[model samples]
Target: MNGILETILVIVGIIWVIVFLLALFLSPKLSATKSKNGGKK
Candidate 1:
């Protein structure tokens, strides 16, 4: 049970890392678009 939980936590951590990296990579483009759109959502 402990090992399973550890594995799940590790997987979740990896996914979070990937998402964070993706956000970092796309943030510039996103900001540019937001600026082009006058920063409105």
Candidate 2:
């Protein structure tokens, strides 16, 4: 049970990191699009 919990935690942590990275990478483009469109994004 403990090992399963640890594995789940690691998987969740990895997914969180990936989501953060994706947001970081797309943020600039999103902001630019919003700015160009007058904050419509």
Q: Which tens-of-lDDT digit does each residue in 1-41 have in candidate 1?
A: 99999999999999999999999999999999999999876
TM-score of each: 0.87, 0.87
RMSD of each: 0.9, 1.2
User: Model 2: per-residue lDDT, tens digit, 1-41?
Assistant: 99999999999999999999999999999999999989874
Q: What residue runs in model 1 are displaced by over 4 Å at the alpha carbon?
A: none
- What is the lDDT of every predicted structure here? 0.97, 0.96
Which pairs clash (backbone N, Cα, C closer than 3 Å) in model 1? none
Q: How well does candidate 1 match the true structure, expressed as C-alpha RMSD?
A: 0.9
lDDT of 2 at 38: 100
